[model samples]
Target: MSVTVREVATPEPGRGEVRVRVHGSSVNKGDRLVMMGTPYVMRLALGLRAPKHFGLGQDVAGVVSAVGDGVTRWQVGEAVFGELTLGAAWAEEVVAQADQLARAPKNVPLAEAGSLPVAALTAWQAVVEEGRVEAGDRIVVNGGSGSVGSYVVQLAKARGAHVTAVVRAHHADRAQALGADAIVDAELEDFSATDARYDVCIDVAGSVPMSRGLRAVKQKGTYVVVGGPTDDPWLRPLLRPLGWMLRGAFSSRRVAVFVARPTPERFAELAAWVEAGRITPLFDSRCTLDELPQALAELESGRRRGKVLVEVHHRV
Candidate 1:
């Protein structure tokens, strides 16, 4: 995928909208997929031949510089962080609906908060909403070393669940450090074939087949698909996760595949947790806005852990 930076007219917020001076942003898997315009299915919404949006970043944290008419929830100079579905967060300034953003906690760094919106929201949706991870439950998070997986592990632990993080051997210690009760080296153990059934099984990597996830879950347990499906594009836009949903519909197990909905309520909840020291967003590397392409390249390399951040405007 080809990416470049350009100077564009600063967007004017419409009614009930707010314009923010983006201080920090992060690259995500959605950004990579949208930029690649791959699997041909995503093109229907992203672009047929090329990307519709010029801006690439989606996770944004910044100060509200201006507010449009009908906006009463936020005022100029309020710090906020949220996801922009239309994608242009890499720029110096971005416009978003007032309802789409939540006030960033004063205790959290704006740059760190920028990395929390998308990944944390996705984890919240999957682990809490879909998985329904409760205290004393045995939960396994595949790809527990990944961006979303890290959140899932932590959130589950926060809820008092016994979390077993499945990751490469190299990330085992980090997973444990993130609050996982047990660390399973995926390279050394076949999680799918293991006889250890769980109360909930969260597939963050999408590396395993539906049957394996089903097998990993107990008879009445939940199996949640967090990330977009992996494999050929001809299957669907988000891919094989749809098939998992279909399979779960007929099974006795509570299987669910859902896309994360990033709203102010969820963002506020996460912000509160961050302020309380319950959830901490991790970053692999920090870069300037001009180095976004390089940051994304590093993301594609699969060597980095957690989120990669871009510091657009340094806080004074």
Candidate 2:
């Protein structure tokens, strides 16, 4: 009943699909929530009993083993990576929609490349697409030490924005080292009441007050959310990055919700960032498939400093 790899028929690529021999898969916080089958709501899609999708991982990096009809953007043996909807990534082979996968940078390791899919896209969408943030803009990234938060700091800096990161005192050094112009130890400082308001805000941690977060941004400034879970799953929805986004738009301050979709363009840009050395991998370690349960527990504890990758190459 576990999401362990088993002997199954090798799935052939359908039109617009590619059969990928999975090398590595990066774990997500959402993956942990679904795995726990929390609040009985996640089970509806994951499975009423066991997970419908047997493979556990959602973000993947691997080589294209076979390309199906109408697939022209890639070829066999090419390294590619992307995020998946119903994760089948904890396997030796997976069928991926061509549009969701992008060519990995030649210089980046496959294991680290898998880390880009969800987190990087979330940062890019918040800063690039929805936030419409520009250089010299003053920005605040709440939970700036988390997976997506780290990327937001780097991306905001690349855009020439003056970035402030709200993280724990323990994580202030790491966030600052990642290029945050200013660091706020939320554990020790009052972020909302600070006179230093921002032109834009990206909430990836969901730890700050909803209304207070909106107020933290200057008039005509924008706020976007990217994370989705907390201790209480139900409240997590309202407190999530998306829910905060909805509440922001209705208020006088501009608010936008971004569910970072798996797109080729975004994936390509992230890969380029990695290639150019503009974005470095924040991957900390790899957890085997058997360690999934413990890993999920650790993630829920809210202490993981970086991406926890799941190695899927053992099936070979």
Candidate 3:
């Protein structure tokens, strides 16, 4: 898969949609998957040979430049941020359905706000909704240094859960700053081999065996798969979770896999968290519209920490 920036006709908003002058957009796992057209299993919905959509950013923050008919919640020039289920967010401007966006966090810059959307929502749902993490619960967040992992750590801490952040050794201090009660070096320690039993195990790294993750959970505990396997993707990324679910069905453990559902209301909830200072997005680097290809290449390298933000159009 290759990326090339091409100038296309600037799109106009349709019914219930708004045209946004994108000030900041961020690269994410979904962008990489869409660009590669991998896990061919998803092609049924994405595309067969190539992506069904041309553009490739999912999280966007910008100003509403135009609003279509029947739209009342937003006005032209309102700053907003949200996720686009369809790719097309990588451009200078993008058209987003009015229902899928919320006002950008007033407490932070639009570049930081652009880093939320998918990762924040995914972490919230996994930690609060599916995992049922609560006060005094012992929770282990596997892969605690990434975009989603960092959020999981903070959200879990806000809920008063005792969090153990499992990550690479060098990121130990970073995870601790995110409120980890304990840090486990995945490079040197096998989390499953530890004596620590957690009430909830969030496997975002997806590097370890599913059985190992399941074993990390305490008896009658929950195991949530928020990311995919690290194996080369043809179908492994899609199939590993299914296999885990099937295994879970026959056991007493409560295991579930989910994809984050984006909505305006969800973004509003995240915005509130931001305003309260409970959530802070982490950034690994910054890029511009013309550097999208290079940014994506860095993302593909798996060396990035936190989110890689793309500056699309600077709003005054």
Candidate 4:
């Protein structure tokens, strides 16, 4: 798929919406999925022939430039960050529902904060909501050095759970720095083949077999699927999640395919965590708006270490 930056009319906020002057946005796996229109099943909602939305961004951080009627929670100049339910955050200005946004972290640059919403929220749901992680729980996070996995390691640690991060040898130190108690170098060993069992197994890499992940979990434990192989254009990514759902019916272990639902409350809590220093955004690299196509390619190349940020407005 080809992408190019084009000029368009600035949008106005409708009722209960606000227009933001976007400072930052980032490339996410979801953006790539949407751009590729993959898993084929997703195309049912995205579009049958082509994507309904041409813009390819979801995370946004910026200052509110205008507000619509009935919106009172935010003012014209409040710094905010949130997920756009639809794509289009790649542009200079975006109009979003006021309820979907939360105040941007004061300690971080808005560009960096833009990388947090989707990745952090996905981790939040996996560890807190789906996994129900608690103190003393043993958890293994596959792909722990990636965007979502990085946050998963930190959040699980904050909950006092013992975290084992599965990453490439090059990223082992990076994962360790994020508070992982142990590191499984994917280049050298298979974590699933070990005798150790975990209270929760969060699979963000999706490179390992589902059966392996299922076997790694303790009885009645949870296996949360955050990502999967995107090589097959048909249903490779969805297959593992669907298999997990089917396995969940009879298995003692709880299997869940994690899909992030971004809400104002969740965003607020994430912001609070950022402010409190419980979690921080991890950036792999950055590019300007004009270079987003290359950034997306880099993200798709599976070579990036963390979030690849797109500096739209570049505010401090």
Candidate 5:
């Protein structure tokens, strides 16, 4: 059931689970896809008529208020962050598997912490997990102004690599502010036509053609697709990943799709990076809780610079 600011039953921590009083939930590209049901395949599991979990939010950062009987490593009132299994985040309370919860970085605000789980994890899986992008590797993050794309830019830079940000002309300046060594305005410059090459090319924009993305990378370079329309019969949510894997096998050039699940270890890594100031999660705009409906509309319109955060409580 979905509700807000009412006496909804507070979720209780089940065995191996914990309940969190959420402070903020950040909207992301996946959340946008799940909300729209565009590819005609997402509803097979997420529910056809209306989603199982009525709440829409996903990336959560808040304080643990209760714990399940078997969970001992965590205590009540500790700041924490993670992804929920379904769509229970927009609501005031959420119950998560205990093993997935992670302590928030000591120096980061809960609101900013909420932005990292999904977006950053996808970037991590792409650069670190699939691409094996090491120090000095050249990475190009297409659509660098969006949530995941923003993190990819910062994280790639943090890895001691050369980073180029590709975004629409309007966001070019903002991308540079986030430490992009250079910016490519997709509107003016056809990044596909450029002869320059990168070791790893991450595409979050989805509008860019797969062939064009592949061309921007050098021989044996990695091309990662995070979201978009896909051609798949099963696991619609994973179509992009599956397609990349299949095509990559036949081609000499590397192509991979990135899908990441939130885990305590990965969340911890995100929190640490943010707290240490090595990675800065560019917040496009901080919206109030009541502004969620409007924010979703704007987000779906496809013009945002960074993470669109719904901050429930100001940093205290």
Candidate 6:
């Protein structure tokens, strides 16, 4: 549960890999789960006693400083952004497969692009891939003001779906600005208990019960679970989603437990969306590399409205 900034050897790119001089990275839910080593079942892949990998970040944006053998997709100075599933993005340099990165969006600062990879990809997958959202579809996004939820609201809206954003009282305006057609303040309203139904129910907050989320979806509609309680020391986060998936078999509605799988093509699509002004990355705060622990603490406190960016090589 403790994090420290320490010096490590500069990593070198191997075959078909590229080393990026990282300018920015951001704290993500995965980072927190790994750092805490919770939901004990994850330990099997991480480590039984402690995590095998200590690096704590997934999203990265920077210039490709070096490319290894057989890598021709990038040059020595091309600006790129991507995700590293196992977490190594907190450092000044990171080595990743050439296929893992995509050209950074020209409309945004390269550092700011770091905030887009994981969260944006998750939203894209939820709204487009999983939910199959389309024009005239009524979609409700739980946690509309969150990092992923913010993008979901916009993406769904851009797809011509009517977006209902379920958010905290303080995040109402932000959700509205994100193109949410309706704002259901969680403090004053329980969207699950409402008579209104949606063609797609995207639960990014995981604050509501799974059955209720499923109930909110119309018959034959889709219920996509993007996140859940991560603080549990045992199986809460994992088990909760599994339970939803199991319950789906008996119900008329479709249920999906979403796990983001990022691809270079998807990254390109997100970049295009940003450049076209269809979606924008939201930021709650910024912090230096050395201050990442504090930034992550703020993220875990559930007080942040959007992405918490960490400036690695700030000069970018």
lDDT of each: 0.85, 0.79, 0.86, 0.89, 0.76, 0.89
TM-scores vs. true structure, each candidate:
0.95, 0.90, 0.95, 0.94, 0.89, 0.95
| Model 6, CA-based lDDT | 0.89
Per-residue lDDT tens digits of candidate 1, residues 139-234? 999999877888899999999999999999988888989989888888888888989999999989887766667888899999898865544556
What TM-score does candidate 3 reach?
A: 0.95
Local distance difference test, candidate 1: 0.85
Clashing pairs in 6: none
Clash count in backbone of candidate 2: 0
Write one digit per residue (lDDT tens) for candidate 4, span 61-147: 999999999999999999999999887999999999999999999988988899998889999999999999999999999999888
Off by over 4 Å in 4: 301-306, 314-316
Deviation (Å) of 316 in candidate 3: 9.2
- Report the lDDT of model 1 for residue 145: 86
List ranges where model 1 is wrong by over 4 Å.
Answer: 228-239, 301-306, 314-316
Write down the TM-score for model 4: 0.94
Indicate the residue-level lDDT of 146 in model 4: 82
Local distance difference test, candidate 3: 0.86
Candidate 1 local lDDT, residue 60:
91
Model 3, 81-173: lDDT tens per residue? 999988688888899999999999999888778888888899999998999999999999999888899899999998899999999988899
Candidate number with the higher lDDT (4 or 5) = 4
Candidate 2 regions exceeding 4 Å error are 1-5, 235-246, 290-294, 297-305, 314-316
* Global fold similarity of model 6 (TM-score): 0.95
Better of 1 and 4 by lDDT: 4
* lDDT for each residue of candidate 6 in 1-316, tens digit (9 for 90 to 100): 6788888887889999999999888777777788877778888989988778878899999999999999989999999998998788998888999999999999988889999999999999999999999999999999988788899999999999999999999899999988899999998989999899999999999988765777799999999999898777887888898898898888999998878999999999999999999998777789888888777766677665356888875444
